[model samples]
Every structure is written in C-alpha cells, then in structure tokens.
Target: MPVPTRKRSPFLTLLPWPERKALAEALRTETVGGLVLLAAAVIALVWANSPWSHSYETVRETHFGISALGLNLSVGHWTSDGLLTLFFLVAGVELKRELVVGELRTPAAAALPVVAAVCGMIVPAVLYVVVAGGGGGSLEGWAVPMATDIAFALAVLAVISTSLPSALRAFLLTLAVVDDLGAIFVIAVFFTSDLNILALLGALAGLVVFYILQRKRVRGWWWYVPLGVVTWGLMYNGGIHATVAGVAMGLILRATADDGTDGRKAEAMSPGDRTAHLLRPYSAAIAVPLFALFAAGVSVSLASLGDVFTRPEPLGVVLGLVVGKTLGIFCGTYLAARFTRARLNPDLSWADVFALSVLAGIGFTVALLIGELAFPDGAVAGHVKAAVLCGSLISAALAALLLKRRDRVYRRLCEVENRDDDADGIPDVYQQGQGEAK
Candidate 1:
C-alpha cells in the first residue's frame, strides 16, 4: 500500500505578496522572543560561573535609588518588585478577560480547568506540607508549586513546536492562566506579613481612586501609571507583597477602558475582546520576555548544586516542583475529566495529558519568587534557588520527550482517520452524482 500524504492548501500557497510578507514578519517577532529568552539563560549560566561572578552578583544586588522620589532598591529588587509589576498587571488583565469572555467565560467551559487548577494547587501544597512536615516553619513555602510560569511553559512548547497540536497548546495556556490566578490568591492571602494599617488604608484608597477613574472611562495608561506606583509603594509598606498592587491596578484599569467599537457607544464590548486587544501584544511581545530575562538570571555553580541538596527546604521545594507538580496536575486533571462532564482536549490522549503535566513541573519564575518570599536569608534560600533551577530543567526535558512520543501517536491516528474517510469515497460519490444530473 502507498503511504497517504496530507494535502496542502492551495489558498495558503496563493496568498498575496503583502499578506505573506506580513505573516512572515509576525512569525519572526514570535521567534525572536523565544530566542531572546534562550540566549539570556545561556549568558546567565556562563556569567554566574565565570571569574566575573562577583561582578554579576554586584550588578544584580547593587542598590539604586530615586532619592527625590524616595525609591531605593537593588537592581534585582527593581526588576522583581518594580518592573515585574507590569508583567503581573498584564497577567491580571488576561485573567479578568478570561473570566469575563474567554475560555473561562462560562461554567461549562471553565469548570474543567478550574477544577483541574484547584486540584493542581491543593495536591502540590499538600505534598509539600507532608514532605516538609508540619513544624519548623518549613510549611511557609506551600504555595511555591502552585504557580505555572506561562512564558517558560510556552517556551518549552516552542522547543517541540512541530510535535504538539494547537489544541494541546491552547489547553496548557488556559490551564496555566488558571494556575496563575490560584497562585496570586495564595500569595495575597497566605504569604502576607504583619499589616501596617496606615499603609494598608493608603493602598486601598489608591485602588478605589483607580477604580473610580476606570468607571469614568479613562482611555490612556498615563493616568494610572503614577497611581499604580504609589499603590505598589503603599502595599509594600502595608506588609502585603507589592506585586498584588499591580494585579489590582490592572484589573481596575482594564475594567474601565473603552474598547474601540462601532464608533458609537463604548459599553458594547464583550469584555474579553476589549481587554485582550488592549493587553495581548504588549504582554506577549514585551513585558513577559523582559521579566524572563531579569528573573531567570540566577547564579550557577558546581559547588552550589552539592550544597543545595543538603538543605531540607531546598530539597522539599525541588521535589515538590518536579515530582509534586507532575503527579498533582496529571492526577487532578485526569480524575476530574474522567469523573466529570468537563471534556478533555479532543486531540489529546492520556499520554499527552501526562506529558503536559510533566512540563507543568517547570516552575522556574514563580518558584524563584516564592523562594525569595519564603526564605529571606540563610542557607535555605540558596538551596531553594538551586533546586528550582535543577528541577525545572529536568522536568522540561522529560516533558518534551513525552510530548514528542505522544505527538507521533496522535498524528498517526489522525492520518488513519483521514485515510478511512477518503476510502469511504464520500466526496467522490457526491461529485459523480452531481455530474450525472448535470
């Protein structure tokens, strides 16, 4: 028997010169972002181990200040706490969009992922708590595994771009967004410190003002930027993690912004289109990649790995992120789909789900942030960083392999189905009948 080949679409081949060129440019932009991230990671690893390691640490940790503005923070802090706020703001806006009109718009569409996210969150934390024990303040890091860094996760998908189906990619993206929402809630509620009532009041007041402005249909971001900065400062002083301010501000701003419509009235948008149109490009093309470059640049050393495994907190974290994340996400998503009405991605098999779950174990960005919050100083923090890097790398590799295998099987099945349809001669039969009548 001859091997059946998939037919190419003539319409795609006959695209106008301009349209094809535009599409090529868009693809280049997307490709560049992934390349940038990979390049950054490679440089960071080399720089961290080089003799100029001190210079790298110094540059990251050196304090910079806007004295007139009363802002003082290390380069790392500025990136993580300040610049990364924009990253979270974009994330928050996306979350709100999804809840209002995207995949999470309806109970039926949203239930599977929400249930999966809840299970994904609860199971990992439970595993971390169990493994670390209930005492010694070790349980503080419970929320670490709850997050899914969408950029890094997507980057992993890009590595095996040819193998994974679009449906699987969409499923993972939605799941990661849901996962991020859970992580944000966990951070806001659990990781907070002693409240400074005055600062808390100031932050709340700032939020209210932003909300009012949004209701007034403010179109420009300039109006909100200063308020957002103040809100972050107040939240920082208020004993809440400052990043929450970004999320809060983004939600209010997006809720209020006028989505361009029929040039008549502004209230006609379905919320998702408005928010996504406003934030998608900025988020994907700029904010996210910048955050990855800054956040993923941890110092690496051969000695650090040996010391990292010796500490309990780091060991627990590494184990939780790699082992706990894979098991929890796969088991949770699988059980929910099996037992409930929520449908799994039509193109994905059990093997595909398991593989994507392993990729979920790549908890680099969020894990690093959580480590910073969980252990401010001491040997624990060092170990946690090492474990996060090591475990994330391992999970990413394993997941990629699994996904490649699953993709081969999935493609074969699709080919078989297509062949069966062609054999049935439905198209040829219809064409022949039409010709005879003519």
Candidate 2:
C-alpha cells in the first residue's frame, strides 16, 4: 500500500510582511555565510588531526582527470583551477553590481575604500617583496597578502557584535570587494607563466560571443556553461591563470540588458528591480557556498606549526597580513577621509575606524588561496597556511577588543549626556527642595 505523503503547509509561509522582510534581511546579511565558513574551518581542523587524516589527504590529493579531448587536470587541480573559475566569475559579477548600483555606485562612495584597498594590497606586497627580495624563491609569492577574505572577515565581524556600526560594516564590505577586484587583476597579470597566444585569442573570442549572447537576452546560465569551460581551457593553456577565465566570462554574462542612464532595463517592466531579483539569489546562495567548500580545506598539525614560523616566505606573509593589513587599511581610509570631501559614516568614530581596520586584517580564505597559487610545492605552502591562520586570528582578536572598548566609551558618554539633559529639564525650585529633603 502507498503511504500518505505529508502536504507542505502554505500557512507556514503566511507570516507578516515585516517578519518576512526580517527573515530575508537576516539571510542576506553575512551572518549565515560566516557561520557556514566557521563550521567548515572547524571540520577541516578536525579532519586534519583525526585518525582518518590519511583519508582526507588522499581524497584531496588523489588525481582524477578528464583527458578525452586534450583537456587534462587532476581532481584537486580541477577543483582549484576549473571550479574556482566559477567562484571568481561570481565575484566579478558582484563587483560589477556594486560599482553599478550598490555601495560603490558613486565616486564619493567608492573613493575611500578604493584608496584603502589599494594601500592594503600595495603595502603587504611591498612588505613581502622587501622581506623576500634577496631570496630566489621568495619573490614568487608577492601577492600572498594582497587579499581580504570576505567570508572570514565577515565571520570575525559576526562574532564581535558591538565592535562595528552598521555603516562601518558597509564600508568594510565595499573595501573587501575592491580588494578582491585588485587581487583578480594581479592574478591575471602577474602570476601567469606560459602563454598560448592562440588559446588566449580563443578565450577573448569566447568572451565576445558571450557578450553577444547577453546582448541578445540569453537568460539561462546553462547555455554559457560550455563556452565558459572552453574559455577556462584556453586560459589554462594560455599562460594566464585559469581562474581569470571566470572573471572574463562573468564580466560578459553579467552585463545587464538594461539601459544604464535611466537605471532601468528597457526590455523589463519593473526597471532595475527585476534584474537584481534574478541575480541576487544565484550569487548569494549557490556560487558563494560552493566556492567556500571547495577552497577551505587545509591539513593542520603540530609539526606544520614549526615549519610555518621558521620559513621566511610564510613569516613575511604573516607579518604582512597582521601588521601591514591593519596599518595600511587604517592609514589609507583615515588619510582619504581627511584629505577629501567624502563624508564619514555618522555612527563611526575614530576608534571604530581603527577597530574595523583590524578586522580587515582577517585574510584567511583569500590569503590561503594566494598561498596555494604562489607556492604549489608542499614545503613552503604549509608555512603560508600557518601564517594566514595565525594572522587572521590575531587580527580578529585585536579588532574585537578595540571595538568592545569603544562601545563601552560610547555607552558612558551617552549616560552622562542623558543625566545632563535630565538635570536641565528639572526646575530649580524642585531641585532645591529635593536637595534640602536629601
């Protein structure tokens, strides 16, 4: 006999508008993503140390490949080189969206973070270059600290509830987006070693074709997936980093079919609203989470710790991420605000700015990715991983402490001001009678 299936209740969805809005907003915020990443990190640590550690290592490193049509890569390489291209594509889409309509929409809105991101990227790279300048292998990992992992940084923010104002959170997010943009550019230009000119041309042609498809109102992403794979193959062979194919493909596909000046897609009824509605869920849910799971796992051990600190390349990375990131971000933002007419977030005091700067130093995910790219060999890679983890922890701690202190100060000031206002409101005769009674 067939069993009765439970009917899904539509009443479960009949909540008030405000409740629905709150739920949506909570989901959109970085909180859920942060929790997911934190869980992944914990799991990675556990897996690395457990008796099944060999299984974890074997699964991650075991070579799986598809060579049927001249394309070749191991399972780990495919995950990093192929799948991660999609991740970067999603990142590129978000960057474009932000610049076009979101937080980085205007020069004033974009300036402070752009400047800060530049400094943040430049200073750490310079620090790494300085520390590693004399060595033969050291120079290869210049881009190691030139990233801000949005997931890890946001996770740190999630843990420290009162350290940042809402506006400051917006500011950090913008800066991180800009930071990612810079890192993409760096990877495309610098890290690539070999050049397959014909493949490069093919990649460019694929982008053009994708652009035309977008212009013709192709909405289904599946249509472009094969072309994107071709683009990735071309880039992989073209001496450009394979991940760059993701960015290039994203730029073409995400171009809104809308007319820019009127802020509406001429073809769509609801203006910019419809386009955003379509892309938002895809970007936030599927793309970002898949990227996190694919990119986050790294083996941890007591022996690995010793190798991490003693190696110059990884040591430089740690210092650059911890020291360079905080100082560079703080100085860049502060200086930009001081010199320019860009208005500061009303809720953020100087103390809050400094705290946010420290939070910006949490560079775990992106830094680790860079380390992987910069050092493919196992020897120094372990050190780089250690540095990223240590630096991020230090930054998170410092930011949390500073933010908590600033919150306390703010509360005290508010209390004092409230007392003054109360005293002023009391009548002089009433006050004198009260004093006499006392």
Candidate 3:
C-alpha cells in the first residue's frame, strides 16, 4: 500500500491550529509590509538623488527630543533608534513563543535551525573580516550581513514558493528567529558607547518591576505602557541601543498563557502572543517603512556604485550577503543532517533547502542599522548602504529563480500524494483509521 503524505511529519512539530493560523497571518502581514518597505526605499532613493535632495537631508537632520528625558535625536535617529523598537519588540515576542511552545522548545526540533542560524551568522562575519579586515580596513562592518530580514525573505518566498513543502517555511522562520537574536546581541555588545551605569541600573530596575507584575498576574495597559517607555528611555540613556529594552520587556512577558485570573491552561492565548498580534501590523506598516525611508536614502551616483564593489568594506558586505549566507546556511544544514543524529524532514528536498538558504541573504533592515553604526560618516555609509541594497536584490532574484523551480517539482510530488486513497475510494486523508485532518 502506498503511504499517506497528508498527516505524516517525521521531523517537524506541527503547531496547534490557532498558533499555526496566527503564524501564517503574521507572515502574510510581513510579506505585504516588505512590499511597502521597498516602496519607501524607492521613494527615498529618488528623493535623495533629485534636485530636492537638500530638503530630504534637512528634514532628516531636524532634531526633536524630550528635554527632561535627555533624548534629542534627529529625525533619522527617531526612525532608527525610536520607531524601530516596535519591530524588535515583535521579534522578541516571536522568539519567546518559539522557545516556549513552538518547534524550538525541544532540542530535536531546534537542532537543524539552530545550527543553520549560528553558522549563517559566523560565516558572514568571517567572510567580511577576510575581505575587509585582512586589508587593515575597518572591521566594524563585519556584523552587517549577519541578519536576514524576515519580511523581505518571506515576501520573496511567498511570491514564488506556493507549492514548496510547508516544512521549508517553518525552517526559515526558526532560522530567522535565531538570526534576529544574533543581530540583537551584536548591536548590544558592540554598538554601545559611553556607558551610563546609573541609566543602566534604572532600566534593569524597570524590567524587574515588569517581571514582578507579570508574575502577579497583573493586567491593563496603564501598568505596562508608561513603564515600557521609561525603560526604553533609560536604556537609550544607558548608551545601549534602546531596542534591547523592547526585547527584554517582550521576553519577560509570559508566552504559554496570558496572566489571566483564570488558572494556567494550555488552551489560553498568551499575553505575548496577544501583544504581538496587536503591534505587528503597526510595526510592519508604519515602523519598518519609516525606518527604511530614513535609513535607505543613499545619494546615488556612478562613483558610489563603483565604490560598493571596489572598496574593501562595501565589497565585503556584498559578498557576506550574497555568497557567505548561502554557503553558511546550506552547508550548516547539510552537515547537521549528515553528522548529527538529526534528520531532515522527508517532505522537503535538498534543492528546497538550497533555495531557502539563498533567500536568507536578504539583509535589509538591521543591516542598514549596523552599517550606520559601523560608518557614521555620510559618504562611506552611503556606499555601504548601496552595497546592502544591491546584494539583497541579487539574493532575492536568485532565490526566486531557484524556489520557483523547486515549487514546480514539489507541485508534482503533491499531485502524486493527493492521488493515494483507501479501499473505500476516499482520499487517504479522510480514510478510516487515519487521524483527523489538521
């Protein structure tokens, strides 16, 4: 008898329906947001190169801040340093959920993505060092390619991978969650300057209070909103990226269930989940696009284009994203499945993994942020930003080509699987003794 394909998942843990739906919706929202971000980038690019370029720069450099809080960031800084925190908060929540209740909860489920993500980060930094640092160039940009923009990657995948194995998307999600964590660690550890111990202590104290509130099953936005703001500000004053505070607050939130008056139950949605759902749309539509507008507006010229490839640092960024990410991710997953006890999901092919690995190279949002941090001077930073955009576009195009080909192959496989049926002439998915269809 032919085996049924509908219900079996040898390697991936299928999430409950509600969680699955939420994850799907979140991906969809981010996918659309990616398109909007692209539009914003285009607008910025055009505006920067236009005769009105001075106006764009004037607007970006305009300063506005709360005097008492000691925050007087420029408009561009407001977008990157302030508005981008929403994105970090949502990412942190997703990471927490995955660790607590999703595939990453178990070592078996985590092994492949964890290995892939770690190598994905390490190889890029190594490649950047080889290209840039080896020449005695500044090594500050090494971490720029260590990120994979989830929205951009997912948008590309969704466009050309309709028939790919479901496990592939799951793998990308977990891999990206781990990638985001790596990026966050790099920003906090390396980008920070002029550490303020008092402000740092204040942020820690705020987080402690937040944890206590959650433990007490506290409710209402009033308790959390102001506290989160204060903590974020304190983190900024502490000379750390303020976005770290968002991640801290998100991690402190309970993931298994909401802090409701009701007893702890498996069925209840978590506060973190609830918050993520509410904030994700705002983050995707407004926060990210805004950041791209400010961060991606590089003054385009033939000279800058040439510099991206000719200069050590900029060329290193391009190679890190285009070459290092693909090699790192594909080789990492391959090594894990071969040498370790881990097994690849039977439903997905090595071809699919390769295509997905290519897709993981779209490092836009955090890449820009890191490039900004690495090179504060406008001229060099513009060249680096151009490199990131060019590299990401090339990766997206290559991944789309490969995934579309794999999608055709998987479509044929799925058609074959759908034909298998029981003696009763029913589809195997609905046959007797089969588990209820998910």
Q: Candidate 3, 265: how far from true, in Å?
A: 9.9
Best by TM-score: 3
Least accurate stretch of 10 residues (summed lDDT) in model 2?
268-277
What C-alpha lDDT do the candidate models reach, one value each?
0.71, 0.72, 0.89
Order the candidates by TM-score, highest first: 3, 1, 2
Report each candidate's C-alpha RMSD, comma-separated, in the order given. Answer: 10.3, 7.1, 11.4
Listed per model in order, the count of residue pairs whose N, CA or C atoms clash below 3 Å is: 0, 1, 0
lDDT of prediction 1: 0.71
**Model 3: lowest-lDDT 10 consecutive positions:** 258-267
lDDT of 2 by residue, 373-413 (tens): 88887767767776787777788788878877877787777
Residue 314's lDDT within candidate 1 is 60
- In model 3, the runs with Cα more than 4 Å from the true position are 1-28, 258-268, 418-438
Candidate 3: pairs in clash: none
Candidate 3 per-residue C-alpha lDDT over 205-226 given as tens digits, one digit per residue, 9 for 90 to 100 = 9999999998877888999999
TM-score of 3: 0.89
CA deviation > 4 Å runs, candidate 2: 1-28, 67-69, 133-137, 159-164, 253-303, 340-343, 407-438
Higher TM-score: candidate 1 or 3? Answer: 3
Candidate 2 local lDDT, residue 267: 53
